[model samples]
Target: MPSPRLPEASFPLHLPHVWSGSEMGAQEGICAPSTHACLDAQLPGNGWPVGGVVEVLQAQPEDHVWRLLLPALGQAVQAHAGPVVLINAPREPFGPGLKAHGLPAERLLSIHADKPSARVWATEQALRCADVAAVLAWLPQVKSAELRRLHLASHQQERMFFVFRPLHVQADASPARLRVMVEGHEALKVHILKRRGPPLASPVLLAAQTGRLAELLQARKGRAAPPQAALPVKPITPTPSLAHLATAAIKGPAPGQQKIKEESNVERIASALDRIALPG
Candidate 1:
């Protein structure tokens, strides 16, 4: 005899952790919504996975790290009320820029490590900290084994973790649960390299800047720049040589000699004034 079939509605689709290969998987643990609507839609669990390393591959270290992760980091700061730790950042974090993105400087903890080992070590230690809500590390020279170690450490903790590596490293195997490649300047073209579900056919375009920062940039681009004022050009007068002065003196007083001297004095005074008026 044939067994009774399960109802379609009775399928385990309702479970938060279960999803088919055709569909994106859902995260059983807590997730931080990546502020980007298109990116979040493509991400598993509709947001960043909290218990795993998210490998971000880019041509340059500082290309789209802020543009892509600012929103999620800002949210993490607010929700977890913990500092976002950064290891081996290429440049010092600009406090004003962070504030413009709604992420206060006080909420960030930056660790400068020159060596790759130090950087990986710092990231692992940061993940273990209870007060850290997120950890972003730049480990260009880090090996796959180090990454796996970091991933395992992150998996034990419930926090957002991101490791940025060179774009060439994508060809190598990684232990990260999610992987993405960031490109473009004005707008980010994010290619989901590896995920729990099917591969993305096209890249997701995300705004490089948003909020007041974007508004200001847009306004500047839209407005026509004012014309620059032209500087006044003064005709240069040749200075009298010592020989010429001697000749003039030897010739004695001629017609309107005093008047000529007075005119020359006025010219010298006007030239001095012009020098003072012009900017350096």
Candidate 2:
């Protein structure tokens, strides 16, 4: 005989740390919502894990990071009242673009480091800082051990930590609590590489832009194109040929003059014939 199963509500009360493999894990603590409803739904906490390393793998380094992280960074800035630190960012943050995403221009702190070790160290230190709400590091060649260090530091400080690495490293071991591969196309495709629940079979397709950028794109799409200027056409006049001119000159004179000219021509022809002599 089979034993009776316990109620679903009793699990949390009895096994707080335990969660079935098929379902998403409970929130570790407070989390930063991803802002994208579709993406948030797939996450274990229904958002970014506040105290764990989140690894983002992409074909290119700087292409889609801003589009994916902007919303969460904006919320992080508001919640922590601290600057969002960027470690070894591929490019300098655009002030207006960040502002347009609802992330304050003044709240961004950019750090540049050429060495991979220096980048890793900076990321760890930033994670430890109480004033830093989030830390984004671009470490294309960082080792798993260095990542483990950052992950440990993140747990101690409890903040939003994202590490950007090349897609080639997906096969390598990682300490990130959540790992997602971002493929850029008409839309951003986020494939869940690692998660607390069952592996996601399909990637989540998200719009490439949102907020003011999305609005601007939608407005531009709705706008009508300006009418093209019509070219001015000139009237064409045909030139008279030599034959036409000569015929016109001959016939255009008065009728009396025309008759006299014809008679003179006939007389000249008759004189030439007489001068040649008769054939008889």
Candidate 3:
């Protein structure tokens, strides 16, 4: 007779560090986007935080960085969550590139504020708009205190905000819920510099259909990227929920902001917002 087989055993504790997110459970309030399963598996919430800030550090400017985030942002837009906003963008908002990625043209808005102070001010305002699906700002000179303020604003409105800093500032301290260092031409490599539960020990590869990347792979790619557009300075009024108007989400970051106001001589920031008004 065959030797008695050992009964199957389950080791609740023994798992890859990558698998640790599962133990944290649904209560952790993690919003892991399925587009990045590996990353979601490593995040505390099993994904990006639903209403938190994610800081991305990149060496050069390219649409690849946006592609890394498009999956999540596109998902939020498709859900009718809100429009995607970019403040002080370095390049023009190429309509073709955005449309190919599934982001609706009408829901796109851009704000151009070159001054660091002005950019920070505009970012705060965009976050206060509760219906905004996501906010992307290129703020290279943002100080830690301002980052903290942006963090607070994000939580208040539960909006997804992304701030880009130079790769050199990776050493500086930050208040963002998640911080990452991204580097790549086609096949992007993401280093999870900081996260909620535990620090990631390795970098995550985020692949995209970039021109250079496609050329290297000898694969057919879509039409060339569209040229970048200039950012508008006026803020467009948000859609009224029709018949009964929707409550205002344009709240300022107060309490702490009151303290900041006393210290800085920054003027109130206002910008033109764009959204195709819908029929009531």
Best by TM-score: 2
TM-score of 2: 0.69
Model 1, 155-228: lDDT tens digits are 99877899988988879998888999988877889999998888899999887576666665566558666642
lDDT ranking, high to low: 1, 2, 3
lDDT of all predictions: 0.69, 0.69, 0.64
What lDDT tens digits, residue by residue, belong to model 3 across residues 1-280? 9998765674354444334542442323437373677666766666677666788898966666766776777777876545677776786554455556666555665655545776787678778775667788899999899999998998777777889999888889888878888888667788988774556677987666666434533432344645435343243455543111111112223434422222122221122234432223
TM-score to true structure, per model: 0.69, 0.69, 0.68
Residue 266 of model 2 has an lDDT of 41
* lDDT score, candidate 2, position 189: 90
**Shift in Å, residue 231, candidate 3:** 15
In the predicted model 1, the residue pairs found to clash are none
| lDDT at position 122, candidate 1 | 56
